[model samples]
Target: MAAAAGPATLPAVVEELLSEMAAAVRDGAPISDEHLLSLKFVFGSSAIQALDLADRQSITLISSPSGRCIYQVLGSSGKTYMCLASCHYCSCPAFAFSVLQTGDNLLCKHLLAVYLSQAMRTCQQLSVSDKQLTDMLLIERTQEA
Candidate 1:
């Protein structure tokens, strides 16, 4: 008998959907309702909150001339959390507890907001120098320390 393959992980599924959404955006095509439904079904409340955050224009994409990008998402609590989508990292407590510590969730709502805002082309973009970006990271780390 053939061995059974494991099901795709939630992170992998989310990545696939995000890729499709990005491609659609690149092609100037609207994201299909089915895709949105799939996202909502997969992510549940996180997805719903992310969609709301994106719609509210609470995400900012800060980019350096060298092409590195970071995201800042304003939480419902009115605090901004730094999100690095490439590394799947967020400075939110939910991310630390749920995603990193307990591993109960693959991502927090802030990361979802970043991904959704990015895919939907809804993020506010700001360009700065590489040094400035580095400084921002250093400041964030210092604050955490």
Candidate 2:
């Protein structure tokens, strides 16, 4: 981090890194050592998926039969996270449970927290916005794709 940079810069940098990681994991390759190192440096491996995004969020990491990555976001808060997998389904109990028991609308605080954290790290126009992060996600996504 540069002395001139603000406290928010770090998370923006980390988001760029995570976007790259997301693109990588989406591509069906095993996560590389360099990526693990980045997570360690950025999030300090404090939580389970902190090392692996899906894990820290308690997402059940799975892949479609065709090999597309799938996530079962098992948030204890009873809400689900987003899914970018081919089918793109989230598995929070609130989603399924309510859908089953009653036709109720749903959005989750857990997902909000996770998304904000991720967005801060990845989405530059977000609260923790940074140009470097925005460019990096697209760059990594394109390069990997």
Candidate 3:
């Protein structure tokens, strides 16, 4: 007799779905309504939450002179984390454990907040020089550690 199979992990499921969607797009195949709905269902909740955080002004972006994307996100615990938008990196446990470990390019709430803000052009980013950015990052890293 064949052995029973367990459920696919969340990351595996998401990765497969995305890969299929990308292939379909590349092949010029029309994505059905069901496919769109499935994608929406997978990301809807987190997207809404991220938008809410952005609306609440919890996400502040700092424009880097070197063109690196940086954001300061005020989390639910009133703690701030540095989010690197381009890299989908965050100075938070969720990024370290979930995203980095799983090799999933998933954004945490903080990174999502920054992403939405940038996409909407609503984030008033503070422009900083390279030296200033480096100094600020150094200070923040030291404080967090």
* Most accurate candidate by lDDT: 1
Give the per-residue lDDT of model 1 (tens digit) for 1-145: 9977654344677889998998999999998998899987877788889889988999999999899989989998898889987778899889999889998777899988888888888999889899999998888888888
How many residue pairs clash in each candidate at the backbone level? 0, 6, 0
Segments in model 3 whose C-alpha atoms lie over 4 Å from true places = 1-40, 102-105
lDDT of 1 at 108: 91
TM-score of 2: 0.33
Q: Quick one: ranking by TM-score, best first?
A: 1, 3, 2
- lDDT tens digits by residue: candidate 2, 1-145: 6577433222366557657766765676665788667655544423233233433445443333343343334455544344333322234444455433574422232332243334333221212234534453455456434
Clashing pairs in 2: 15-121, 15-122, 49-55, 49-56, 124-129, 124-130
- Candidate 3 root-mean-square deviation in Å: 9.5
What RMSD, rounded to one decimal, does every model reach? 5.4, 16.3, 9.5
Q: Which stretches of candidate 1 lie over 4 Å from their true place?
A: 1-10, 24-30
- Between candidates 1 and 2, name the one with more favorable TM-score: 1
lDDT on C-alpha atoms for all candidate structures? 0.87, 0.42, 0.68
Error of 3 at 44 (Å): 6.1
The residue pairs found clashing in candidate 1 are none
Better of 1 and 2 by lDDT: 1
TM-score of candidate 3 versus the correct structure, residues matched by position: 0.62
